[model samples]
Target chain A: MELGLVHYLILVAILFCIGILGLIISRNIVKILISIEILLNAVNINFAAFANFGDLDEAKGQVFAIFIMAIAAAEIALGLAILIACYNNRHSIDIEDYTSLKS
Target chain B: MEVLQFLFFGMFALVIVISALGAIFCRNIIHSIVSLVITFLSVSGIFILLNADFLAISQIIIYAVGITILLVFSLMFTTTKDDNKLWLAFAPRTILAFVVAGTLFILLMFNITNKFTDFNINPKSFITKAPKESTIELLKKQGTTPIIGKQLLTKYVLPFEILSILLLGVIIGAAVIAKKDTNEKNRASESA
Candidate 1:
């Protein structure tokens, strides 16, 4: 079968759905963060694929992907830091334990 | 050559999907993180296939190595031995999650594939534009790094600077948030 743009899009859609599933169902804070990473990766694939196929001259999609990578790095750094802070306070990594703001 | 390219794409896509599933479902956090690394590497392979050579390298550096290390370090800092069992929640909301994700996937697939008919029969009529041959030739010869750098400095300079600022803020914020409070320690010692 010839690989087409639809193939990449379908693959990314599957990855994105899996990411959403993980984000919703996982109880571990770390796993939630990993789900976010997966979602971002799916976006990156979409951008790169478009850059390759749609606009190879400017490659603006790839530029946006780079921007996304930078933001993802910053996000995970801060997310882990917050996770560590919460772990220190409660001595637990479960998301259900950190529901103090739910009131 | 065309068949070879298709085979490579299939391999990378398969690896990406399988590893991504493993990353979420693996019981041990370490195993999940390892699976995440595999997924990232496979994604980089896809980038290479898409001819984003520079992004492929950056994916290896940023996601595969840097992010994996940060995740492992966070896991080490936060987990006890018992945390291994803290994988999935068996709550009723788990079913809700599956439903929502399934619906979203169906919606996206329906739209992208033109109600699932275009996927196999008319894949070429999708959102993709025909790439200019000269640009492809230039990309093949010089690679994408210089193009990316030029774009970042010219068209995306403002966002580029903002990203640097964001990184600085993240570094400081993480350090502050994770640091032990000296005041709490002193008070506990005095009360003891």
Candidate 2:
């Protein structure tokens, strides 16, 4: 079958759903961050695909994808820092253990 | 040529899906990060297939190497032996996650396949002017880096500067948050 815009969209949608599933169901803090990265990647793929098929002249979608990658990097940095801080305080990476605010 | 492209796409897509699943479901946290690296690499491969060479390279650099290393170091500091069994949650949220993900997937597929027929039928109609054949050939040959650089410095310079500022703030914030509490340590030493 010839590849089309729909093929890329389908792939992205599937990845996005997997990201969402991992984000919600994982009990580890690192796993949750990985899921968030996966979700950002799905969006990046969509942007690149649209740039290829729709707006080849200016390539704005590709530019946006680059921006998103930068933001994801920043996010991961801060997230890991927070994870390390929380780990130092609680001495646990399990999401269930950090429920001090649950009362 | 087209057949080879399709084959590569199939391979990359399969790897992305499988490794992404493994990234989340692996019992070992280290194993999960390894799977995540594989996923990021294959996603970059997908970007290459989409003719985004620059983004693909940065994806490998920023994600496959940079982010993976950050995750691994944090894992080293935070992980315990008990973490192996705590990979997946068994509470009520697991069921909710399944329901939500499944519903979103179905909704997206529904819209993509049925509601947006014109997008697949003829993507060119969405754009006012078709890119010249020569420009397409040039882009295919030289890649999108030049165009991306030009646009970044010209049209998107504001966001570019803002992103640099954001990165600076993140660097400082992360250091402050992760740094050892010197005051507490000093007090403990004095008391001892």
Candidate 3:
């Protein structure tokens, strides 16, 4: 069968669903971060598929994906740093452990 | 050529799905991270199939290599033992989460597959019949990197500058938080 836009859409849909599953099901905070990355990639696939097959003149989707990557990087860096500090204080990285705000 | 295209798409889809599953479903943190690496690499492969050359390489460099390494380094600092089964706690919450996620996915797929025939409802672009080969070549000639350059400088200049400022703040905040002072926190981290 010839490949069409729908094929790409279906693939993206599956990946997005999987990402959502990971986001919800995973216990580890790091795993949650990875799931968020998966979710972002799914959106990126949607953008690129549209940019390529959609009638747009410019690849705006690719540009947006790049911006998403930059934001994700910054967010992850900040998150990891905060996690380290949390671990330093509580001596644990598990999400269920830390229940304090003033620490 | 069409067959080759189908083959490529199928292969990429398979890789993406399997690796993504491994990344999420794996018991070990290291295994999950490794699976994430494979998932990213295959995503770059799909980008190449879509003729997004710059995106393909950037995805490889930034995601597959850079982010994965950063995550691994962070993992090294924490001492979550592999022998501990505490991470896999099964509860009523897990079941509830799965039910919610499944319902959401089903709803989205039904709406998407049934209602939208063609996503691109852009009237102007829809009016003209641009041949596929020519458009691909046009994208190549116009070049994605330059258009991105133009957009970042012109239309998105404000957000771009603000993001840089935001990133600077993140770096400084992270440094202050992670910095080793001659204190109990540092001592705890050092001994842990």
For residues B44-135, what per-residue lDDT tens digits would candidate 2 score against the true structure?
A: 99998888899999999999999999998888888888779886798799999999999999899777767545456334434434467987
Q: Predictions ranked by TM-score, top down?
A: 1, 2, 3
Better of 2 and 3 by TM-score: 2
Between the candidate structures 2 and 3, which one is better when assessed by lDDT?
2
Better of 1 and 3 by DockQ: 1
Q: Considering summed lDDT, which 10 consecutive residues are worst modelled in model 2 chain A?
A: A1-10
Predictions' DockQ, in order: 0.79, 0.70, 0.50
The TM-score of predicted model 3 comes to: 0.86
Model 1, range B35-138, lDDT digits (tens) per residue?
99999999999999998999999999999999999999988788889887787788787999999999999999888877777756236455567778898789
Clash count for each candidate, listed in order shown: 0, 0, 0
lDDT of 3 by residue, A1-103 (tens): 6766667777888898889888777767788788888998888887777766664456677778788788888877888887777777777766677667646
TM-score for each prediction?
0.96, 0.94, 0.86
The stretch of ten residues in a row with the least summed lDDT in candidate 1 chain A is A1-10
Top candidate when judged by DockQ against the true structure: 1
Task: List the TM-score for candidate 3's chain B.
Answer: 0.80
Q: Which one wins by lDDT: 1 or 3? A: 1
Chain A TM-scores, per candidate, are 0.97, 0.98, 0.87
Regions more than 4 Å wrong, model 3: A101-103, B82-87, B115-134, B140-143, B181-192
